[model samples]
Target: MKLYPIESGNFKLDGGAMFGVVPKTIWNRTNPADANNQIDMAARCLLIEDGKKLILIDTGMGNKQSDKFFGYYAMWGDHSIDKSLAKYGFNRDDITDVFLTHLHFDHVGGAIQWNKDRTGYETAFKNAHFWTNDNHWEWATQPNAREKASFLTENIMPMQESGQLKFIERPQGDFKENSELGFGILFADGHTEKQMLPHLKFMGKTFVYMADLLPTAGHIPLPYVMGYDTRPLLTIDEKAKFLNAAADNNYHLILGHDAHNEIITVQHTEKGVRLKDVLTWSDVLTGY
Candidate 1:
């Protein structure tokens, strides 16, 4: 199996929202804010080449949204899924599965696109089966007030309408040892209901996709939760538990939202589990 980092694009979000109740004076040290108080964020997705099945995890916020809607987000950079795929000698058609971490726009937006006629929406990966758990599908389709804005109908319904949507086997409890997609699944609820975090062993090490549960290395601290989380107290407990296991087992966390910090490992520190090191893709590729 071969894994590649696919950068869909970059955008900015309010640092305060990203870090939650944590004051800017603290988070700003790591994730500095711009004049508008927004910080850089990456729609970085992962591509897995397992035999003939090309699986893509989390499609970034796509380009189909109107300029007025996108104005809220400071979208920047020339990086795109097309160029990123072509970089590895592949294309959208080659993807056989799109494993969504959640249905939020930034994570699942690129899964659907405007059809050629602009009459309606279509699945972005024409040949792929879009994957999500049953619980998450229900939660997203029938969203609550706090999450309604993040779960856009256009970004979601098309996959179901296209008849390409699929679900992973969800087991009772916070973590599932194995998923249909061939990765262990970690379910987090603070950010969104039944949000799945993917973990798979690769390149002689274990890698866990930290999708919002631990968005960035800066969030390694238990208290650095996001304002977007519906239950901040629950997030604190979840982070504490996950970070302990990550430190004990030496799991390498693949960050989903952090634009600059790609991958990381944590160690037991006096304060708590802290970042052991910030690593680049090349560093992980060489297994140093």
Candidate 2:
């Protein structure tokens, strides 16, 4: 199996929201904010090439929203899912499965796009089966007040409407091993209900797609949770358990939102689990 890190684009978000209760004095040292107090974040996606399957994890925010709607996020950069796919000598039609970690706009917006006539939306990946869990599908479709804004209808409903949406049976416990995608599914609730983090076994090693569960290496600290998380206290416990296992097993973390840093391995430190090494995509392909 081959894995490619797809660069979708970058956007700005309030550093305070990204760092949760962690004070600026602390988080700023790691992720400095701009004059407007927003930190840069990448909508990096992952592409998996295995035999007859080409699965994409997350599609980044698409370019369908109005300028006024996008003005709030302060998006920048020329990278996009289409351009990134072309870089690998592929196209949207080449994807067979789209595994969404969650339904947040930044993560799933590109799953659908405006049709040629501009009359309505259509599945962006025409040949793909969109995968999400039953619990998250319900949670996202019937979003609570706090998360409603992030779960836009245009970014979601079209997949189901297009008859391409499929739900993974909610796992009874922590994860389901070697499911359809040939990986373990780690369910995280602190960030959002039943958010699935793929535990992929590739190149004879384990690589966990660290969605919002661990947005960046800077978020390795247990206390550095995101304010956007519906349950911050629960996030602390989740991070502690996941980080410990990640450190013990030496699993490489594939960061989804970190703009500058790519892959990282964590180690148990005196303070807590800390980044052991920052790795590049090439380093992953070449080994160690």
Q: Using lDDT, give the best candidate's number.
A: 2
Q: Where does the lowest 10-residue lDDT sum fall in candidate 1?
A: 175-184
For model 1, the local distance difference test gives: 0.91
lDDT scores of the candidates, listed in order: 0.91, 0.92
lDDT string for model 2 (1-288, tens) is 889999988999999999988999999998999999999899999999988999999999989999998899899989999889998999999999999999999999989899999999999999999999888989999999999999999999999998999988876788888457877889999999988898888888899999999998889888899999999899899999999999999999999999989999999989989999999999998876
- Once fitted onto the true fold, the runs of candidate 1 whose alpha carbons sit more than 4 angstroms away are none
Model 2 misplacement above 4 A:
none
RMSD of 1: 1.0
Q: Which ten residues in a row are the worst by lDDT in model 2?
A: 170-179
lDDT of 1 by residue, 51-77 (tens): 778999999999999999889999998
> Which pairs clash in model 1?
none
Instruction: Give each model a TM-score.
Output: 0.98, 0.98
